[model samples]
Target: MSIVVPVYQGERTLRALIDEILPLTSRTYSPSGRPLVVEEVLLVFDHGPDGSADVIRELVSDHSFVRGVWLSRNFGQHPATLAGMASSGGEWIVTMDEDGQHDPADIGGLLDTALDRQSSVVYAKPTNAAPHGLWRNAASRGSKWLIATAMGADSTVSYQSYRLVLGEVGRSVAAYAGSEAYLDVALGWIAGEVTTSPVELREEHGRRSGYNVRTLLSHFWRMVLSSGTKGLRLVSFIGVAFAILGLVLVLWVLASYLLFDVGTEVQGWASTMVILLFGFGATLFSLGVVAEYVGVNVKTAMGKPPYLIVADPADGPLGRTATRPEPPEHTTPT
Candidate 1:
């Protein structure tokens, strides 16, 4: 089994997180009574100004299973995580936060659930998930709700990356390259037997998350846009429903003029103005949704990579590192 952690400015607790994980390696049986031999720990160090890259390099000198992949720059958490998973070699892959919030002790439970339930993905749902400020919590839940509305309730299982994935399944997810990849939604597509278990979450030791409100909002938009056809379908339904209603209202107005002469004889232009504004606003919003889909296709056609591989060195704890692919000379088509 391998634990894939994407490290970014985690100078505070990287070492401690590794120590907590080492105990999982010593365990003989997984939560499901299967023999366990931790294969590796694939840590992708996202580009940061801090000494995190140096720390990862130092750790690689001694550990064979602790592998590191450095990006040229910060490509956001979802992209960095995809890069790490692409490089993992374990029969089972587990992705989690580098911050100490995701408890390593829960790894056993996740593994056990995966085997017993015969699930491709067993998630560590943070029942006691650590609380950020109240507003943060609300925003997080709001994000989840948005995803659930677009995807299905099944897809919004409230599972963070602190979950176990079958090796093949993980690779399948990594194969899904998108400019706006949402980790949770991608997992929902490939993972069957998706079950959630309670796990304890923790508070960060030193630094607050590098992700700001803008970043989170950006991520949310990408998630909704690139997730799948679900959002599009919802938007389409809404558009059609509005069109039908508008047509009905027009018909009613005409009928009133021809037959009873009610709403048509109303005093002023208030009703007409309200109708015009509502129609215009709804049309613009729906058009914006359609434009997002077009933008995704444009990016894919231009051959733009969802993320870049900056500085991946060979030889580390996870085994000898493999080289990342070089990007094409031209990022976009002329």
Candidate 2:
């Protein structure tokens, strides 16, 4: 197994977190009876305002297992994490924050949960409240609930930063996931065997929390988009419902005017409004069509992959393609 921690303004707490993880480097074992060890601790620096790079360099020099993945710029936590996971080669990859909130000792329990349930991923559910204040915590919960309920990504409704993932699944997500892709949703796209373990989040030992309203909102919107086209479908449903209601109202007004038999003025006004509305709706429809094309172009520009491979092909021979049109001698060359 390996550990991937995304560091951002965490210079003060990085070493302490590593100290806790150092003890479990090779002495532990997973529930499957295999010797579990953190072969590498990847500290991904997202180029924050602190001196985290220097700290990562020092740790890399001190411990052979400690490696640093420095990004070109601040790409936020999820991107940095994806970078770290893409570079990892362990059978199981455990991602946690650089702060001391997540305990490294509890990793064994997560592994146990993964093995017992045959889960490809295991999220560490907080047994206690988060180490933040009320509004921040509330906003976080609200955003998660909205994403799960509104965006239809309930498979990852319980996702948290601290989780255990199969190494191959993690790497696959990193490879194909878009720049703004929500990490949990990308994992859900491939790994269907998901579970959660109870683990209390420890208080940050004097480390500052970098979370705020803006970051929370940004992450929420990304989650909604990366979850699929459920949001678009919801908008379509709402528009269609509203249109049906408007049509019914128009029919009622027309029926009322015709019943009076002396409502010529009102009828003419209604007809004029109807023509104007039709023209406006046609213009808006044209713009909507262009926007749909723009949306597709934007998604392509965002680097969202066309597809992702969760696992190897079934019954494929080792070091060979799955199928060939002709014989194996000259048939399967790509």
Candidate 3:
């Protein structure tokens, strides 16, 4: 097992986090008795304005399992996490933030959730409200609501930092993820089964959140774009609905003279202008969606993978063979 932590400004909190995690490595963490071990704790440094690099160096030198994965520059949280996953050699990988909001004690519950559900991935669902300002919490909920409505997605598609991923799936996603990819969304593409475990989030130990309002909004938009054809489908649906509405309006106009006359006694000019404005707005919105997709695809075409390995990972619960339940060897007569 590996814990891949993406660090932005964690100089003060990392030591405490590591100390908490170290105790677990010496004991059992899996309820299924699957023989799990914490082989590595990878702290990915994203070059923030702090002494994190120096702290990471000290941690690497102090603990045998602790290792530092440094990026050339700041590449944001998901990319830094992917970089760590790409380099990990463990059979399972757990991705969490460095802010200490995610408690280390809950890792055992994550493992149990995955094993009991026979799932490829398990996400942590906080039972209490997130430790953020009221407006920030509201915005987060609003964005999630918008995503679920627009994309026709279920609760499993929610964004979560504390997640346990199958080793092969984690590494494969890290390799093939596009430039603007969201980590959780990328995981959803191939994870055959996913579930969530309820946990309580602890407050950050007197630490300020790294994300400001503008940064959070930008991050949300990137996630929206990374949803992969969902936004485009939404636009398509809107366009179709508008076409149907226009057809109904046209039929109503025709019926006004032929049958029970209504909604067309006034001059047609006002209605015509309203129709024109609606059509133009829809057309421009569709064009904008298309342009956004084109730009993302162009980036994918240009960016090469950062890491490569000789072969696939060992078989786990999400393996092709594992996904299919085995038949009973014998059956009793009914």
Candidate 4:
């Protein structure tokens, strides 16, 4: 098993988290009787304001099994995760936050659940409340529900940082994930077998959350955009409904004019303004949706790599010994 963690400003908690995880590296038989071991722990360092890169360098120098991938700059959590997934060479890839909220001990239970359910991915659903304020928690839950509903996934499928994914599947998704791609949404697209394992949420160690309200909203918007162009389809449906309603209104007006001899005076300026406003509003809304899809397509066509690695573990401390050509730029298409 390979544990993939995206390190932001985790200078304080990352070492401790890795220490807790290192003990679980012992070889053992899984529930299915297959031998299981934590072969490697991959840390993808997104350029945060801290000395996380130094921490990762020190860790990798000390432990052979601990690998480091240094990104050119911060690419947010999901992209950093994709970088780790793409670089990881393991049968199973487990992703967790660097904040120490995810217990390394629960890794066994995640494996068990995945095996039992015959799932390609298993998310660790928190059994207790998350370590956030009430409003934040509510917003988080609401966003998940919205995305799941939009994607037609099970409402009970909770998304969390703590997850276990079949390595092949994770790598496959990572290879194609676009700049706007939400890791969970991309996983949902490819992995038909997804389940949840109940795990108690641990108290955050010392680090503060990387996400604030703005970042959280930005995350949600990206997820919505990446899930699919379902919003465009919805707009089409609304346009059809409005067309039908307009037809009915026209028929009513015609009937009144013919049967009751109602003159043009009955059609007031107020009514005309309302119809014009509705039509203009709907048109702009549909155009906005189209523009978003076009923007995504353009980005994909331009070849935006999810994350760029300045260093790889195989090439020594800072990839100074690398002798291969740089990877081709690529991103998930809209």
Candidate 5:
């Protein structure tokens, strides 16, 4: 099985992550007597301002299994992960954060569950974690809740990136045609025999996280949009609700005009204003959602590489590629 670690500015912890996982490759074994030899650890470096790319290139030269996939530029986490999976040669694929927040030990458990269930994807669910600030926790919960509501509560909540996937299944998902590639949502689409096991989140040291509020919001929006018809269905329901409300108001106005004599200023002006504002708002909101759908299709049709391969050794069979046909256009200036 191969492990893929998508490194984006993970300078402080990347070395440790590699050190911890490399030994597990040889130590972990299945009952079938096949030892887990990590055929390759595809470290996809999305050329960030951090000097991580240079460090990873040196690491790759020193270790045969430590292959560096340098992207021409940043293409966000999901796309970079897909690129790493594309480059790896393992029959099984495992993805984990380069930051030590996700324990490498969980990989063994995830693998065990995958083998036991004969499952396509064995996701490591987060069991416990050190407390984060309230807003951060709330945002995290919101993200998970949205995923659970869309995918299924059983399949989501307490979800972790630490996962083991059958090689063929991973490739099949990677081939899924969508510009907004949210990993969890994408996995939700290909719901093969899937199961989850609980794993404790490691204590995070005082390093700043890569994903801030803006990034999180962007990711959440992509997830909602990529979640498929459930989102559209929700929009449809909302539209119907608004249409009914508008009809009810109109009927009430007609009744007042015909018999009740409720006065034009009170009923006509206020009701008209309320109905006009809400009706127009709802119409625009619905159009925005529709536009999001159209935008994804249009972006996919543009034939761009989802990411770029920046720094693989010349002789090595580099495994990663961008999502669109065109690669990311820049590397970190260094």
Candidate 6:
């Protein structure tokens, strides 16, 4: 087993989190009753304003099984996670937050569930309400619902940070992920089966959430965009509906003019303007959708890699000296 965590400002909680996780590396057993030893813990640091880099260096020096990967800079949560996945070499890979909210003890349960159900991925679903204010929780649910509806996924999937994925599947998804890839959505695309296990979510030890309202909204928008082209299909449906309505309106106008001798002059300019404005708005909306799809295609054609690792554990104690080979330069399409 390999445990991967994306560390941001986790200086205070990392020690405790590692201590809890290290013990599980020895005591846990697999489904076949063999001792399940965690081969290594890959901590990928997403450059943040904290001393976590030093902390990780110290931890790596003391523990043999602990390895570190340092990114060139902060690459958001999902990208950092992909970096960790790329570095992991184990039969199963477990990912969790650095805030210490995910209990290390739940690893056994998650593993058992995954093995029993033969699932490629298992998410740790919160058994109780999340540790947040009512309004915040409601907004979180609403965002998740929007993503689910847009992606045509089951809303009950309950995507979360704490998850267990088969090693091969995780690496494959990370390798092929594009610049705008959302981890969960990518997993859904490649995973053979996905399920969830009930777990209690603990509150953060001493810090508030890393995300605020504005960041959360941006995150939600990115998730919708990364899921797929379903949003464009939705716009196409709306355009069709508007076209049908416009046809009906034209028929009504023609029938009124022929049967009752009512013409455009009797209907007045206000009604005419309303119909014209609606048509104009719908046309502009469709164009905007098309533009978005074109932008995505251009980025893909330019060969945008999802994540880059500037440092790895094989380098030395700090793992800050290693570097990945440069990716091929972007080439213009014919």
Top lDDT model: 4
Clashes per candidate, residues 3 or more apart or on different chains: 8, 0, 0, 2, 14, 0
Q: After superposition, how far is residue 254 of candidate 3 from its true place, in Å?
A: 4.7
Lowest lDDT sum, 10 consecutive residues, model 2, at 306-315
Off by over 4 Å in 6: 30-34, 260-268, 312-334
| TM-score for predicted model 3 compared with the true structure | 0.82
Error of 2 at 60 (Å): 0.9
Q: For residues 263-285, write the lDDT of model 5, one tens digit per residue.
A: 64643567678878988988888
Write candidate 1's Cα lDDT for 237-273 as tens digits.
8789888988998898778778984653455388778
- Looking at model 1, which ten-residue stretch has the lowest summed lDDT? 311-320
Model 2 over residues 254-318: C-alpha lDDT tens digits?
Answer: 78777856644644677778866875775576556456545755977977553222221112343
> In model 2, how large is the Cα lDDT of residue 303?
71
Off by over 4 Å in 2: 30-34, 155-157, 255-299, 302-334
Q: For residues 25-79, could you state the per-residue lDDT of candidate 4 as single tens digits? A: 8887654565679999999998888988889888989888998888888899999
* Model 4 residue 90 distance off true place after TM-score fit, in angstroms: 1.3
Rate residue 287 of model 2 by lDDT: 57
RMSD of each: 9.5, 13.7, 17.6, 10.2, 8.6, 9.9
TM-score of predicted structure 6: 0.86
Evaluated at residue 141, the lDDT of candidate 3 is 93
Please list the residue runs of candidate 3 whose C-alpha ends up more than 4 Å from where it truly belongs after superposition.
Answer: 29-35, 252-274, 304-334
Off by over 4 Å in 1: 31-33, 153-156, 255-266, 310-334
Q: How many steric clashes does model 6 contain? A: 0
Q: Could you arrange the candidates by lDDT from highest to lowest?
A: 4, 6, 3, 2, 1, 5
Model 1 clash tally, residue pairs: 8
